[model samples]
Target: MNAGRPELSGTFGAVSSTHWLSSAAAMSVLERGGNAFDAAAAAGFVLQVVEPHFNGLGGDVPIVSYSAATQSVQVVCGQGPMPQAATIERFRSLGLEHIPGSGLLPAVVPGAFGAWMRMLAEHGTLPLADVLDHAIGYAENGFPLLAGAADAIEVLAPLFETEWTESGRVYLPDGRPPKAGALFRTPALATTYKRLLREAATAGGGREAQIAAAERAFYQGFVAEAIDSFVSSTAVLDATGRHHKGLLTGQDMADWRATVESPSSLSYRGLTVHKPGPWSQSPVFLQQLALLEGFDLHGMGLDSAEYIHTVTECAKLAFADREAWYGDPDHSDVPLDVLLSPAYTAARRALVEDKAAEVLRPGSPEGRTPFIPEQSAVDWPVADGSWMSQLANGLPTVVKATAARNDTCTIVVADRFGNLVAAVPSGGWLKSSPVVPGLGLSLGTRGQTMTLQEGHANSVGPGRRPRTTLSPSLVTKDGKPFMAFGTPGGDRQDQWTLGFFLAAVDFGLGLQAATETLAFHTDHFSASFTPHESRPKVLAVERNCDPEVIEELRSRGHDVEPAAEYSLGKVCAVAVDEKAGLLRAAASPRGRQTYAACR
Candidate 1:
């Protein structure tokens, strides 16, 4: 409950969404002669097995790594692409009008595996098999489930029980969700892993191995068949289906490929920041930083009426630009030039009413909206006109929910070597598909991020990845590694990341102090793609915030709900202290436990 703490001291370390992964991978990397990148990859691989309800091979990873040797930083965008066959007309033919909460539609060519492969090829010194050894062993043997994971399993079981092609395998041992702490494994995933190694060996080059294996195993091999059949089943192909009009075909899958993009960035408060273009608000958050420099943050004080009011006011101003000018820059001319210009920043700052909350301004800015067209995908084949929720492990929730990757996980590895790897591979659809035995992995129903709306900026289209809010971030000072961090709560990721990064750099707070300081988020669930997509009616707060602070926020024109745990993007991080030659790290304290290792 304390606001400030002295933690994250060490020479090397790692963290995950689940505790088992947090400890196991850190230990494995330390055992090897490898450094942070190797350990992070190992941890990522292990998470797919042990924490499969969210994130597996079937997800995307946008990563940032810092290299001390070169004193340079690099960011890779691995978010996947849409199916080639996707189209707005496709949805009409399927009698569908909106994206489903089950995350069963708008599935793309998963890119996380490819991202990992690329990271290893360019930066990792250890062998791929070696990097993944810990994960494979956990899948083949067994790993204990953490408390939160067990609860997630119970919470999403009902939704996954009878849906999807692989339903029987995940839900039925004799047909039931496994109890908490039960050992789980997945042989299918194990085979997939081995297949990758064999492909890696015979592949023309190291780079080709990861791609070849992923394409062969998931797209062209058994996984593809299972997926194709699942997509073509009576449900998705039905005239009345709620998801896409038809299941996926080999051709659609074949059209899928991971794309590499140039990083778009800007200067804010003397720091350089980068984010993907088209559907990312990194530029907007950056502009907010530039404008906030003019404000007297210390005068307003932390979490005071003026502070929250000012931040919220600035967020509204940024959102105004976001709603109108932020979209896929390739498809539309997002007014980024004008939006990020100094003129706009100064003008917006001048409009802020210091003493009174401006409750009337909407997120949309003046002039033409720059967002590109959004089309609906086909998720047809319905026998029943009605829809229902399938619980996973009978874990009760405080919110109404469809499903996303609630079992979200993160990994940060820093070694004696200069390279660093911090990744968050996440997205889980349900609980019914229990963690399989021997595979240590779960399938991702990542279709949830797509828009069902006919012409929204974030739509399901052929050859396009959905616009995602999950971003892995890196920070550097004077061209050297300083920190790598991120969180998993959908839209809340940016808000949390923005808060902590500012606190750490601007105010020079320690890791725990920066992370634990009062934080606020602007977007409500009402602003999301769907309402009731999460547990209902809660303000998702750190349990330790002073009760009066909660009351004061409630007094304002905002809803203040208290959470006893981390809700929006559970953050995990590692920062390199060059002077000390150490890697300081910590995981979200909202969980039962998370371990950090140092040499």
Candidate 2:
């Protein structure tokens, strides 16, 4: 297969990201002799500045990393828990059955900063100032805005001005949204970072101590004070069309910290695939792989009717389980061991029929009953009428209009010494919540992923993590680090990443070729966000797919919809060839800003 872009190859290091600037920043760190963790941390902060509509400093991140020295793979659990005041009763008092997708009420303890700081202090060689320089520069001096950011600002301009005035003050200058390619600056965000650095400098310790100081400033000191003051003083309009105060407080931030945990893994074809545990939807990827291992995927041609149908069916089963059984293990019994066991996967694999199944069916494992939420008849009004109206015109509109609301950013980095990091930094999108006054940041709406239904694994509760769709991928071949990859899609993250992995591993396609191949996903399970909607048996494939395959899928009881060629995913990947001591990277051409850098 001719990959639209040449696969990047380097002898020393490589980086791939959803944005060109972020990839370049990571590559620069690599050239400066920083390890993969340092490069990834720098790239992550840069992403917050360049992809403001997709992520920000107030967001959460989940990271998977491998170190040659330890020869172990670990997860950075950056998905923050709901605040102390976040309770089902409090939401019910406000007449809310589900958390709103855009508001302070759904804000969790911000996890990105704490996660990055921990990674830098423990595994990285660079100082906090070094890792944050790129982001601070872009925030203070300005960076060229991408078309997507400009378009999002344009769409949300009216809402910002009327309902989120603080956001308007930061995003719009002179009362107008910035145009694409225009230099945009957020001095307030730069100031916030600078203040943290200054506090770190005052600590008068080595690199580790300085990093700890910065972390304290963010969670226990000035940053926390600002966030607490804003939320305590304001009542803002959210997706509920009601003004509400936030549940998060300074104490909540002080109580939370990112921690390292063992990753959940499954072995297939002599490779071990790793993902975060049940706190995220990551284990669903491993579960799908377990089920897929029983099949001869190589015999099924790529994107063929049979191949697409089988993959879609397997995904439906896995996501059904995610909706039912997956949650914060600290709060719920996830039953991951039984869920990933060979016997259980074999049983789940038996459910995949030649014909598409148009229902949400979660199977019993170890005689444990699945906790599927009852489908509510309540109809919530679409937050944006014009955008929702456009969805009826065509299949492509389904993704284009909804992409910003459901998108995240991915980063993957590899160093010559055999260090690897794969991270998905997301949440706190510009449109998701109001910007914190004078901080140039917005709180995450991840709390929207929780349910109000009692006894459910993912029911809303204080200090519980909502089920997150942000997942990154890592694989080791023959006990050696092989690849790190991920993409930016809400529910489609695992689907797209799984396709990319299978194309490369099963069919022997190169990174670029695998990433560029036609992609498809199904909306069979309830969405992870607010107003959880489900479109049973619906499969949306890109226009690049063979028309015959599309028709054949439609013939197999699939409600097939046509997606634009470049609208499916924004995947980025890096592979390390241990024997050859070379690094390879690839970034999807689907988006204008995605890029790969190697040096």
Candidate 3:
């Protein structure tokens, strides 16, 4: 059995995140008397500096927060929408069937900055400078380069030297990839933040005004101008083996802002789970829970083949629904209420059997016909100028097929005030696009996840949000904050987090043990990212599972592949133990970089 890290418990505050530096930054904010929202924003910005390979300022974030003051949960939708100029006809005119995974062509209105500022302005008490201090410090002064970041830089060095020179300027300062563990700094990013602070100071009011000013500085001022100039003037090579200009403009950025909305919630085993709506793949997690609520998961045993098979099958069904029904509700009519209804869930649960199902089946929610995009058999384009090989992120090394290269980062925080927040910041990887010349950040390629096929729920359209895979979760028990948690695996976010939630709630495991438990996920449905590969009936299990169970699953018709032990997920979670007046936190040991802190 894998040994679990001790759960962190305290009366003050707790934080868990995918990077040690980000966790520390949040803990520092809490120690300074900042609330959970303040701490989360601090950690979010620090992650932008430290985990540039996974996320950046130009990325998107979906935050689910529970405020103790209001006793309510809200989703801060940081997911940016497609540029107004982006349309199916335009892509078709270019003879493109899908949005390119990496380049200016797939750029969206960068939404992370606006989202963080909005949350801070409304829910937090700290000044804008106070929250941004740690990030600017890390970017200006040096932090030890993470090994994964080093490797990503190394792989992309050739591409940087030849084509994306702006990225080369920031990442390959000495004309080479920096060695792992070496102190690294991005002075330009620090300058950008400092300039934003100066702009915020000009607002001449309190904390909220400053935050609002910072948001404007990013969306309408210098940052947006730099992005617009770069994208309008420069054509870059993408997955399509050619150079193309993006559709995003300064007006697109100016016109967009993050909005707060009610989360899609479900009740299971006395706990209420809240997730971002269909615009993200988050509701699928709740759907998986609703299906599993019918089964006796504890009786099946955590490592037993029955447990793994049942969970994987339910995940397949839930994700199939996600592919067929999920989209930006403003642009598409999604029958989410019917999909999550008890009758529909019961009918879908009946489809799970002893033998693994090989076909993708989306239920007709409300008797409405579901649209499943025709499976395209063409492989991702390969050419001398193509950079897809180096762009893949967060996939286990054991997997053979190419998938979404845009990985992500997570931060979950719980303060003594009973406030809780979970945020998944993703996209705009350093390798995804060329950095803006002055801004030191790349525009996110989130637009790549939107399909070009018309009449589909996630089809590309003007101002429509992509159905993203960045999902953060919040759970409340008895109308009080229970836990805030998330992980960073495109497509597998729901699968991995569902396992963690089950191990803790159903098996009565501590948070650390729950996170350490062996996890499994099926790639049976279409992926949400670019290349959008589907692996029917393939179940990827961590090697920590008993080998006997693996054979049992194989005999039951699962095409089992063993992933490296502790490689399936990197979950970061913080829980509030109201009965004991204690806050708890745990970070998975999978990545060796995640950390949790309490008190």
Model 3 — which ten-residue stretch has the worst lDDT? 393-402
Instruction: Return the lDDT, model 1, position 9.
Output: 72
TM-score for each candidate, following the candidate numbering: 0.83, 0.96, 0.97
For model 1, how does the per-residue alpha-carbon lDDT over 457-515 read when each residue is reduced to its tens digit? 55566665566655676666565666777766555566666677777766677775666
lDDT of 3 at 57: 88
In candidate 3, position 403 carries an lDDT of 29
Candidate lDDT values, in order: 0.56, 0.86, 0.88
lDDT of 3: 0.88
Worst 10 residues of 1 by lDDT: 389-398
lDDT of candidate 3 over 140-229, digit per residue (tens): 999999887887788778878888899999999779899999999999999999999999999888878888888888989999899888
Q: Cα RMSD (Å) per model?
A: 4.9, 2.6, 2.0
- How much is the lDDT of residue 77 in candidate 3? 96
Using TM-score as the measure, the top candidate is 3
Comparing 2 and 3 on TM-score, the stronger one = 3
